[model samples]
Target: MHSLETVILLLVFVLGLALLAQRIHLVFPILLTVGGLVIGFIPGLPRVVLDPSVVLLVFLPPILYSAAWYTNWSDFRQYVEPVIVLALGLVLVTSLGVALLAHSIIPGFTVSMGLLLGAIISPSDAVAATTIMKTQSVPRKIVTILEGESLVNDASALVLLQLALTSVTTGAFSLENALLEFVILSVGGIGTGLALGFISFCIHKHAKLEPALETVLTFVTAYLAYLVAEHLHLSGVLSVVTAGLFIGHKQSRVHSPIVRMQAVAVWDFVIVLLNGLIFILIGLQLPHVVNAIRGQSADYLCVYGIGISLAVVVIRFVYIFMADTVSNQIRSLIHRAPIFPSRRYTTLLAYISMRGIVSLAAVLSIPEKLPNGSPFPGRNLILFITFCVILFTLVVQGILLPLVIRALAFGQPSTDYLSRHEVQKQLSQRALRQVQRLIDQDKLTGIAVQAVIAQHQMRVRELANAETAPLLDQHQLNQKLMLTSIQAQRDELINLRDRQQIDIELFHEMENELDRQEIQWHPVSG
Candidate 1:
């Protein structure tokens, strides 16, 4: 077991590197990964041999939940077709193409082994994609599609991987059975997640706990969705995502002001730290993977890794283009809307293949030996190739994506904030009108209306006049000022902790309160 001090030291290193990454305006995951590689080669530092189980249990649920929580359901539904095609169809195509290539090129690799490897690398990491996209001037629609794709693709890939692994172990493969199982598990996971979400909502509604307890209950909801789904042999990833989406959709109606206030801050804290550690863990495992590849010649390994990486990249372009052509042609024949396939956006989407620690965890989860006690076929080569593909995609594709965007002259930034804020302001006015109706009916006093609706009136007026002001996130003009003050207070608290005027525990509690306040104040559009 790793000691407490070792874990703390690793985290401290991650923190320092994170600051450096921000200072240089580099993506945090990229730089932190490189930092990890550097530390991995050093002789004296303790080897951070992370278990596959740890990453699965600790990192996966929170990371998936965070993405699902922030995903806007309306946008998801509107773009359901494309999201499903990419998340479901593209995953299958990529896996099959990789499997075919691996089975053909690599010596002594079975179809099942190839399938397992393909599934391991198929799911694109949106965190890595977003890190790249955020630095560039990508279009908002492309970003949104990539984000939505990343949220649910793991379910498709993982389920496929499990089936392939079972095939490899049992020396049998059944396509019809796999499809039926996929349907059952996927549907069951969705049902389980929605049921769990309902249970959480009811618990929060009836328990009437304080914000702290409610926050804990929300965490419980997330873990339960994953664990219970897995216990029932369903897709745990999908379950957690489904639950997160359900709760996020109903959040405003169900959660109290205080619960809403605390949940975001708590989740933010959990996700960032968890993600940072996983990246560092990714970096730390480089040596172990490199060592494991000694069973094969380096030349063969490099050729296979680089060849399959290029093939997968090429396959994505082909599949997307084919999907676009086929969908558009069918839609035209049926006299319906086009597939909304922008050439430039499609090109950008094709480049969002940066895999992350998830890939590593999945690859590591492969067993060392098969059921009959013989070593798992091509296991070492799979490990090395998985590592190589991840690094190449993360570094090469990640760094070049922005340059490509610039080349296409399509890096212009856009936001829907102003339009959404205008809509919100309009709704607030209608609400004011409703209040006026109540006053006219003598149900509410006019004086009371004026007192209660001053903020609403100010917001509408500010939005009306703000054609010149740089658009901020909220409809209310004062939101920026409030955020600035909250940030200043947060800094002050950190400074106090640094100066040792407060203990770390006290500092965290006070800082979390400020964080909760900050989150609660952030503008949301319906």
Candidate 2:
């Protein structure tokens, strides 16, 4: 009863915080964490601890799939070197560094436990990365590297974390078996995701599903990959991401206009709610985690937390200078020219790797007891430390991320966005040329062809404003004239209504007729 009430109040508080975030044009992740910090100390407020199983099994798949679906495959592949370095290479480096640092600095911390904690905090959050990229004038390639890293790093970290947790649980560790497990699970998850994606594509392309049913399939597809991979003891995170990448890449060719429209709206709504719930849940769990760590001195814990946090920051900078060495060596063996990103790119990459919800969830999900029924050693401390790292990265690193980006001063305008605009213009022009040829051959007539060409011209204007898009052809000129006449009629109708020359019902009837004709001549969206 009290627990249920506490849950409701927390959700209500999250809702209010979201509104405040929008009002101030602030990032919601930071604000929500701050909100949680505030509420956690409010005396009499019931402590709310998130169920780890619910966080992993229920909350992760959809949100993850949504991120993967929106990821640009071309960008991911184009920056493959840096992406791999950060996602796989950097994760391994950071995990090992944290493990060594924790074991050396903190008393009674075992290698396995330190490894578990390291993996938990190693992932740079997809949400935080995307938010910072959007809020700043960061270079697109830099954004691409961060976003790509975010997509795949979780799989690396989580798999490592699980292996560590297994070591802690059963008191058994084998390098040969662990290596085999990593290979098989990762390969199997990718294979399963590809198979599910193919099946989804076949259904979407051949069945001609209605928008509603197709939208339902989108949700089902996200969960299906997750369930299948986890069932097979594979990496569910990778499976969901792989499947989403497949379907999203094929969206335009497999789905109709209406299906695409409906799916976007539904997915957008689902993602927003999911992100809000996730950060809010993260905030609400802090006080409970803090209160549980009674074994350690408060001062000791804080100092330890600061040390771990600093290790995370400093290690990234140190590692950044070293990571590309792998790529450089590979290139050298092949006799290719050496390539290194500017120092600014390296610095921005280091700064933007902010931790968030998944880290907290991973630490919280640590087993309550070992195989012999003893309480998991240092579980509460691990949870407290993980929360501290998340707060520090999400708040401190996240806040300073924009400054680093601005200082990078990547003088080039966003090449990706400019390239997209150019591509759209070229495509629109090509489409117009084809339509004009049809009219020239008399397969299409004037007003009808003019209407389509006008639409294409409008598209061109959208990519490049009207002043810059080429001067209108005769057909477009006539189309614009027709729209002008229609606007005149709509205005006249409104004037008649205002003067009471026609009843309200009659005015609407006449206006609707004009609207239909207007749509026929010029289909412009406000």
Candidate 3:
């Protein structure tokens, strides 16, 4: 088969596996990583080549943007200090710690090489953490803190990585200059992202395009922001993230529902595919990495991998505990200060530091040669170690995370029924208001007003009855049966439309009524 055709087939297969795995309540991200590893071992599979620059440019933007856009900005702002500590401060500390350890432990390894390795894996992958944590019923605050930290940490890590790499390449290391450059890059990146976001937002507002067209524009915006930031020698990851956050927050107010829905679906699919492909690429590169270390003691690679992985894991645990302690103490001193609310939730957040595609991509990006025209020391070993660490965290840690939550009794009780009821109540109230307004404005005559009022009153009564019903009792079995019947009918009608057995206009009219009825029955909260 042609290379492109082969890749298309592989992606289709991976997506199929993802769907099946999700059905059984397995985590899709970990499944993909494992699938990639298994596929990599197959001798005849096409190799997945990745240029570090291309990986960063392609994957980082949409992933970061999606996290930022969906993130609760208010919560993120409230917990900004802790997020910064985890994202920026923790990344630097981890990098330094790893560098020091590697320099001491690995024979003939320079501090610069050690720091480069440190920088490569310093930032945890947001996509991995968000995907894994999303399936659990964790508190919203903890989720927000993790999502925010993951989005921004890459910027910090990458900036540090570049500075360290420059020093290593030129044999000139200056702490003062590195610090100065870090500030300039960060400021420049944020400015670029904001500017790009605003420009994209303006274009979306002015152009009355099809939903598909607007979705395309969003894709374009991600890449454009990255390229612009990179050209200006700033952190591309930060720039794309900022633009996404800006656009996502404003998208709802500006775009039509059709555009918003279409864009969200498209972006979601893109991220999944991109993430899957990255993991697959990591697995595919393993053969080459192993070949690079051939004739060397495989035992040494094993030890090195274990040591580095342990270092990364231990450092994160220590850093999270320290940071949370300090943050809690500070919050305790101020009466008006917001608290994290739950220590157990915070600990779960610490355990969720699973590294995935981004770290692999960064490790894969290591230069082939150092400044002295010799091969970069332990480059293959680093890649091997990184892949091992990612697997251990993503597969081992990912699988065990739920058990940890359960052991700690961290899962929030299911709120699905309450949420559904709340929605129903809000819709019923809205409908009543609309009918009353019509009568007041003389839009309905006496007979029409009475008929409308009767229907509205009936809905209100039904909602009230449902609200007062014992949640776990079978006394209101008939009402529950009726609700299920109505829902089933609605689903059947939707299926009919999907099967092309109904016309669009008729389907929509019926669907709207069904929605109204469902809303009245469920009574959701705002």
Per-model C-alpha RMSD: 8.9, 10.2, 9.0
Off by over 4 Å in 1: 135-137, 371-375, 411-424, 427-431, 434-459, 467-526
Residue 217 of model 1 has an lDDT of: 83
Candidate 1 versus truth, CA RMSD in Å, comes to: 8.9
lDDT of 1 by residue, 82-185 (tens): 88999999989989989999999987788888999999899888876776666678776676677788887887888788788888889898889989998988
**After superposition, candidate 3 runs with Cα above 4 Å error:** 126-137, 336-338, 369-374, 411-420, 427-461, 467-526
**TM-score comparison, 1 vs 3, better candidate:** 1
The estimated TM-scores of all candidates read 0.83, 0.83, 0.82
What is the C-alpha lDDT profile of model 2 across 12-118, one tens digit per residue? 88789889988987788888777767776777765556565556766667877877877767667767878887888778888888899899988999888888888
Report the alpha-carbon TM-score of model 2 versus the true structure.
0.83
Worst 10 residues of 1 by lDDT: 467-476
lDDT of each: 0.73, 0.73, 0.72
